[model samples]
Target chain A: MHPEPSRSLPEKAAPSLTGWGGSPAGPTTLLRPEKMRDFKPGESPQIARGMGRGYGDAAICGEGHTVLTERLDRMLSFDDETGVLRAEAGVSLADILTTFVPRGWFLPVTPGTKFCSLGGCLAADVHGKNHHVDGAFSQHVTSARIIPADGAERIISPDKNSDLFWATAGGMGLTGFITEVSLKLKKIETSWMAVKHTPTKDLDQTLDFLAIDDAENPYSVAWIDCLATGEKLGRSVVMNGRHAAIGEIPLRENNKLDGSFSKQKPMPFYLPSFVLNKFTVKAFNSLFNLRQGSRGEFVTKFDPYFYPLDGIKNWGRMYGKKGFVQHQCVLPHESARDGLRAILELVTESGRASFLAVLKKFGPEGRGMLSFPTGGYTLALDFANKPGLDEFHDRLDGIVLNAGGRVYLVKDSRMKADSLPYMYPRLDEFRKVLRQYDPSGKFASDLSRRLNIAGD
Target chain B: MPGIEGTALVLGATSPMARWTAYALARQGWDISLAGRDVQELRRIAADLILRTGATVSVREFQAEDLESHEGFWEDCVDQMEDLRCVVCAFGFMGSQDAQNEAPALAQQVMTINYTAAGTILMHAAKHFEEQKTGWIVGISSVAGERGRASNYVYGSAKAGFTQLLSGLRARLSKSGVSVLTVKPGFVDTAMTFGKDGVFLVADPKDVGGQIVEAMTKRKDVVYIPGFWRLIMFIIRSVPEKVFKKMKF
Candidate 1:
């Protein structure tokens, strides 16, 4: 049964919001609710927003309402012996790491950024470098409490309300407002990682290092130099890491599980647009290769190992006020090599230098219907927002579609509506679940509206 | 570091600042008693604290507006935890200035909760701590209390009363070996200022909570969260009265 509504409505304000990419800004009514009871649906359509790390329009609703879940963060309970934790969906992965890492526990699967809230992780079903080993974030979640359109709270798991569970797992907050989540955490001996970096000569070698059976480490990802061409195309630095055992660390580092790391320095202001062009990015790429290629093996803290960019707060501002878009797509194993080569060649030809490029391998298809991962190779590239960037991305999407690949919904801001069906074959199933739960489309976002995911 | 062996009673435990302060205290090895109007919410917070810190947590229903029951509430807290050595008052009401200006009742509610109710309970705490001759009391005041402004002077006036109350109590108990900390936070990213405009240099509640704990450990009397707020408030207080009255900030 539904609980009583809160005596007063949550604090509301109209704020101009944007995703992490910073492009496509719009004004939306934001509701900051402190408790579950305050999650009352109003006349306008609504979607839940966490830390706004989705990189696109998924968290922005425009004229609709965006219910912020950050304040709802609280650790509900934990099972020390079993390494299971129940926490409010608004709890950030950073908080979890701070609280549990020192106690010898770690997140089973975490995205590149720890600033993201648990609910956002579930909505996106985010994957990490260890996705080939541990699967997506939602796969580790045992159960969740969600407040759907009807305002009734439902506890869904993989076995109970399995359809709804799968739908909400990667539904992008389309099905409900995720309030709480319970997940199994991984146990670790230290808060550090033993990392090995190997520079690949070309695209083929990079793919070989990330091969499913050939992968020697639990976490693996490659930073590709997208500006390369011909024989040097896709030259990358492959980084592989595993949890450092107590014995593997130095004697002076006595607190093996010390989670404390260096503080973040804010990117004081937006760098001028001209500051990051092809010439500059290419130079930076060359220097990075030279510096990292020599660092063959080392022990590093988890913060820098997993989230190198997080060390610079608001690093996205470097993309300038106009912002940039991240296009991440996963191609099926059979056509991954060809697909990646074509995409890289196009990026090099277009002169849109992507300063940050990452490639990883995925395991089997995840349980979430719209989960982005599959047994394939995934590539993520960031491009500055320019006049012709939309047409450029369209061509990239065309190549991915031909290769039987799908674009990650969380990172997409301007893909065509028709591309949705081609990318996610399970769109019909996601739509079916939405119709059953929220027939009136109470929960909608700019992403859903642009792509017509609700089929309204 | 070893855990502190005393219990801390946190009033208005459901507020964001109180929740974080309680967490900071519990993490430092202090048992906690959470009191608030919403008993259900307090229970959830207590459970969370217990789970995270392995500290003993007790939930009690408290009505800040009911000044008469505060004395009994203090007794219950002392009865429940014999080693209660810290009391934190982290509760206040911020009514809309425009609405409070129109309704006398609204203004009264805001004044009573932020000043009268808070002051009454703190007096009881002051007596108990003074008698024990070894305890700490923390009051969460605001920078708004430092000056009167047209934007939120009603709420500011109440906070001003609270700030002075803490100041007076600190003076009265100076030689009693009991310490009182007056916390003046500016633009904290809490539920109270979640969507408010013109909020710059917003400090995270977690950091503010951690700083409060540090200040208490050092026995600091008055502190401005983020530290820079002291300079900002100092500049504001230095403005000439005629100029300040005409300025909108």
Candidate 2:
């Protein structure tokens, strides 16, 4: 037989990397494997990174190997009859949408940014606007091929290796390097979304609007005015959407099935840190409320409805070089109102002026042990990195803890290690699975280390 | 506009550049035969291309270093696509210069895969295209072949020989209605240069692939990816050999 092609070691480079937040940057050895055959567990304490879209350090393995899966992206097979797709973990949701949307297929659940990798979605168990109706991303994942520290590849699914599968669903890549994933795709009639915008005068009305069970609309999200206090506390414009039927789209428009959207010019450079102060943020928030709230009801392309921020490339750079931290937490239905009010009041009193504030209603708890979603209301806020921000976060965390809520590890850059157990009652079970699969703790990240999810 | 109705055979189909090129061709409504050593990998690529573009795709086994098997490989490709109109050669070995310096076999293998075997396959394609009197042959040579640098002279010399081969074939087939386009890509962001140091102005394989298809449609004889590389290579070629030998790049 012809000699097997030499297994040339995958390329390696030492580069200073950061998550999308741009803070907590560290030097690491990055191994980029281009083909599936080339993907191997090369170093201890390694993690897989795709697009580095995670807000914090979930994808970073500081001073260790960070296997970049971007180049390994390739859609292996697609069954049009069943709408099932088998793709490499590095494939971006944007790529999948570009390929399948015209074919009348869409992702069952997609986060705000389509730039995220499938593996990252699984690791974070990312939830979408439809979480209240559907669930987290892992719920649709049929199976995945992962290579742990031992370099032995295993196929884990709900029916087989069920514990490992559950642990890996939202295990944050601490379990292994996810190489490939197979997921079910949602079918759509058109590329447009029939959306309705309802303006709420206060937090109570906003929560009420979000809690409404509009059978037709499968997706809903709210853009909150974090700066508004007192009477207008938590003023928001809730946007509800569902895939538009072909009959709903205008006949005059050409290419009804075309899902492509215009991309905005990238942010040229990092704005000065002072550019996002309280006054500017308040003005922007007010303008946004006016513009979006007035839209009322309209049919728009799926891109703007699902991934509005993705229109501007590298939009995170708008937060400036020091970067910003996004604090996203979910409070159960019983405590959501009080918890969100306390959190918003804290922000307004501090005059921090969060640039973006969002809230979404989640349904039943997910099968993933560490998944962020549950029967709750999740609120996310972004605060610029400035002096005393950590202290501010600490206070916010305390409020969440007192309300019996837990921070989203994917969005979190700073959360006390001690509070993790209380936040996630199943942390011990997740650790037990990690110990069984990677007993030596071969996988680690800054977030995991900071939270001590995997013991030292 | 739809591409001319025919199939394009892409050798070394598993390489990042070749895969991108195949995608560009498939997007233009061209049927494709993706030939490579890894049939399993090629099948995956074939399925992907079909899923994305809905183009008819077939995979064939092609070992670049198997000199004796190339003629039969071309025959099989022709059998699969009776209306084959184009062939793209996009495979090469870029062993590290330090390793090539220490190992004679490695250097020999690099030269053989990049030049000798490549030339043999192209010769078979040239004969078939010359008889058909209407076809395109695109070879991915390198800008390093323009002026050999001490850092990669071994790889550069093989590409230089391949470039010369394409030049001769172009001249010979000029009256036979066959066109040959030589591509001189600078640093491409593929697996070959994923983490290599000092690689600048790297062109994306997708853009390069698109430009190659554009060049084929326009029937251009030679083109540099990104176009700016033409000037870069010109300046390097203008340098005197006496000074170049001592100057390290």
Candidate 3:
């Protein structure tokens, strides 16, 4: 039989796109699916994009179709009694938090940024500050509805299509386009957190403090002084917090929670590239440390604690027009100290100062095929995109691989193709599912093609 | 109206703008009756809005072309919500101007859906609000109603009449403490124009929803969505008839 000819498909108009990091993506054909029912996996290669909040090019498919799921967003159902919420894949974390936070419910797991979509979070298998206790975002997800290249919607859960579910949990949306997700939300007394600041000097104390001994405080994260050298190297101010009880806040009415969406200021335009340099970062880091250090034990809203960066709109533009690359890697507990120290040494020598470097402790390995978090300490550092950055990133990847650790794919823009299989041991299984779901390799992205990841 | 702050029956609640507005209203603590011809879509929107806002949301059968159903619908909304203080009529029909030029019947149907049916529903709502002596009647008119153009004069003409009717409704309903709002949105990115060619500067439903929330809270008589559409339409309305006829936009 002959293929259908002269069928008028959606026009392939070239449009320049970029991820949250502001890295330039080559022109691609964009499609906005207005409704969940309207999405179709046509003949052309395509990738589902929501909010385009991914730091890398995972959402972009250059010279191919890129389905925009922003319009497909709508809350499907939510059981107020059970706190089991179901919504379209395009719904943002900001929407969920804004609507549900005041209702005494919170996401089981949330990343630092709330602008990301449900599908994007699931695809990344994102881990939050609570990774030490709650694991990854996939663990909270009860079920998801995914449409493969064949356009058949399959509902996957831990018990149903378990292989596909686990593969898709961090499959980078290669298995299929997620249309809907049902997840359990944690009940909260208020949208406020009781926080304490503990100042740690040097890497050893910082690591020890990050272990978070107090069971009452489930969330712990450290903002390390990456630029510090000698005795001050790895000095950090650790913030430990837990949900604030009704009496924790000063409000007389215990039922009232502070779920305000205030303090929004736009960056307006890209700052000059030279604005963030060695001297500037050092000064900002010092100031930030002092600010954190001053706050001994206080009760604050969830936004400032979970998402301080979100207050400023277009905050990525502050990185400059060329954007910045964030390198985040995790090493097992045994090698964490040495591995993180080696990476920091490289950063110290590079002369490319990072304004902020974070360290967090993880509980155990997740079940997702390509889940980024494991039983380890993860170090995250952001560097302005400049000359010789690619080679430097490759060197850092080498150090991480040598330490038997892996880099977070969500934050990575330029990881080596060969290193992926080494880090994600279940890559073979994921590829098999991809082949079974999308046999013709119809689902692809710039990240997939560059990394030599196969869908068929 | 005595005990409840706001309870609305949203007609054509499945339309992009209306659906988003319903969610906004629910979030603002208004119990909503998501009434539309497509009850399936209405039910989904109602369920979604109820969950997000913790607002009482229910689906009802409301056909835009069914003018006879107006009386029973408003009564049913009041019965269900117990204190229906608002009726948001987001119903309109846009037809191809090219076809309207060729077929007179198509033009009449456009008038019937955009003008006749809407007025009947609003009239019933206005009477109910008049009896209660407190309510809101928000109508999402279009920027196309600002003036007639060759591109979509049929839609523009029908919308123009609808806008005029809303203006009259606003004046008459004011004495009874029933507020009326005319939302003239410019280019809106919606399912109707999903894959349409050559559309740009289309505002988001979320953004438009925010504007609707402001409108309801303030009870503005007439406003343009995105607010900028007001100026754009102002300039277009100010253009002389001779110049307007020559212009194609």
Candidate 4:
């Protein structure tokens, strides 16, 4: 066994990282063993972490040592024609996009953001706007190089270690730290998008439209007005799109110049804590809605339409000192409308305003045990961190639970520990697999503690 | 009579920080009013509080920019609240600094929104809280205000003004039972930070919200969310403007 970083023996630990949700409390020492040979059997750091992007505290190492695999980022191989990419767990989606998108390829599934590591994608079993057709990110994943607590780095897939494989999917990085991942990438003609925007009256219409037309589009999402009430509640504009064909491209210097889009600027500083009130948001939304509806049909560049939120530099500073919270939940198909309505109604009643409220339909269940998607409808609402926001979210959690839905663990901040099982039916199986790999009870996070997922 | 006995008003209550601060306070059993421009949305927020915390909470249509509506709204809020404990300002804007530099009008809009309107409302809130004497006023400030950088100077300048304003207000209010807490948060992960890359030590609104409540309950003077922001801003501010401007922050 290799010498421990600080302590000789493992301890009950929680792993913390700057994940998409929040930073969680984990163990103090984060050990990094360079190669698989360097890892000795039965000498684990208690827990392992990948590129920390499981939103909440799912990947945090609670009260024990953690093994960071960021240095393990490396490309193993690639299948040119099939666009099959096999890379180490540390490989970031951003890295993949920068390298592949320009080569006429894209991720089969991606979250709203693209900063996640491959291991994190598997841990959270992430999904994307195209989930209506392509399903979760795990659907594209063929296999992984997982290093279990026992210090064995082996390639795992559905065919081999299928139980452990599914467990790791949505497993929140519990089964092991994925060292490598092989995934299938979708081929595209060019870095252009053929998008069609449709403005809907409210949530009902938005849902109806999505149900009717979601099948036709590869990427679809609706931006809802969570603050709208009465007749206008859930008013939103849906943008649906597919990759543009090579022959359809119009010649433009900027578009054709480098065959890639320009990098977006970052918001640099915090604004004074008074500008983003209801008046401003309403006005902005009004203008935005008007623009969307007025534009009619136009084939614009892919970057702006698909990632408008990405254009702004350091936009978070706009929320001022306190920051904001995103309450995202996915309800099964049967309960989607009611779940959406209830959540929206709660937000409306609370008078909390959201600048961007996104709604999407997931295509299928991923192989990961704790993965987020399960053929359902997902909605994410962004709220500024005013006082009493937690109470508001807790009430939201109740509404989510009452509707037989659950908050996405990746995006949750206020969910009750007991409520997790209600959302994921296969919790017991996930726990069992986690324990099998980590019998020492290492590998924990504040989310796991808050939701009682692990560290019992 | 206008102020509730144990209630606090949250300006821009829907902002992530404001919401979190309010949540932090509510945990201590303090009644809260999640005030914002949308009356309908405020009421919903109030209902949500009632359901979650079982707190006697309510909401009102509060527009800081609409000076004319202030008196009546304050009066209405006072009538509903039992023990007006505090007023928290968690409002701000970060319009593109480049856009502001290009369009002088946009710069004015940024300053007016952050300094003029928000400051005026805070002054109004201070008067109420000061008169009550047994109240708290927590204003969410930012480290950017430490020293304006060209990257987002318009926004930074406005925040600087507000930060100074809060500091002065705190100095005056210290003697009174009314406590003023200034909160400076660094990077935060929200819709606003949707596309940001390589951001360091960013915080979540819920965490900040929890911290805000903790500060309020503890009655601290000034607190920094994610703590490291304090050190970060100190170092940033310490750098000479000549050197600071030369280096990309």
- Report, for candidate 4, the interface RMSD: 24.1
Tell me the lDDT of model 2 at B157.
Answer: 98
Candidate 2 C-alpha lDDT tens digits along B1-249:
354669999988988788889999998888999998888889878988887788999988899898988888888888878999999999898777887788766788888888998899999999999999989999999998888888898999999999999999999998999999999988898767777778888888888889998898889999899799999888889989998898878
The list of candidate 4 runs beyond 4 A from truth reads A1-18, A21-52, A213-215, A253-261, B1-249
Candidate 4 lDDT, B34-107, residue by residue in tens? 88865654554454355335567667676666666767777776777757778888767776667667867777
- Candidate 4 local lDDT, A325-373, one digit each (tens): 6788878888888878888888877777777788887777766778777
User: What is residue A400's positional error in candidate 1, in angstroms?
Assistant: 0.8
User: In model 4 chain B, where is the ten-residue run with the lowest total lDDT?
Assistant: B189-198
Q: Supply DockQ values for each candidate.
A: 0.41, 0.55, 0.29, 0.01
Candidate 1 local lDDT, residue A437: 89
Candidate 4, residue B127: the lDDT equals 82
Please give the fraction of native interface contacts (Cα pairs under 8 Å between A and B) kept by each candidate. 0.48, 0.45, 0.38, 0.00
Give, for candidate 4 chain A, the lowest lDDT window spanning 10 residues: A1-10
Compared with the true structure, all predictions reach lDDT values of 0.89, 0.89, 0.83, 0.71
Question: In angstroms, what RMSD does candidate 2 have relative to the true structure?
Answer: 1.5
User: What TM-score do all the candidates reach, one by one?
Assistant: 0.94, 0.98, 0.90, 0.60
Instruction: Please give the lDDT score at residue A66 for candidate 2.
Output: 88
Instruction: Identify the leading candidate in terms of TM-score.
Output: 2
Q: Which residue pairs of candidate 2 clash? A: none
Report the number of the highest-DockQ candidate. Answer: 2
lDDT of 2 by residue, A1-456 (tens): 234446665455556588888886667778877677778776567889998988899898887888889877788888878888999899999899999888889999999999989999999999999999999999999999888878899999999898988999889998898988999999888988899998899999999999999889999999999999899999999999999998888776566788586677788899888899889999998999999999999998899888888888888787788999999999999999999999999999999979889999998998998988989999999998989999999999999999899999988888999999999999999999988889888899988998999865
Per-residue lDDT value at A320 in model 3: 91
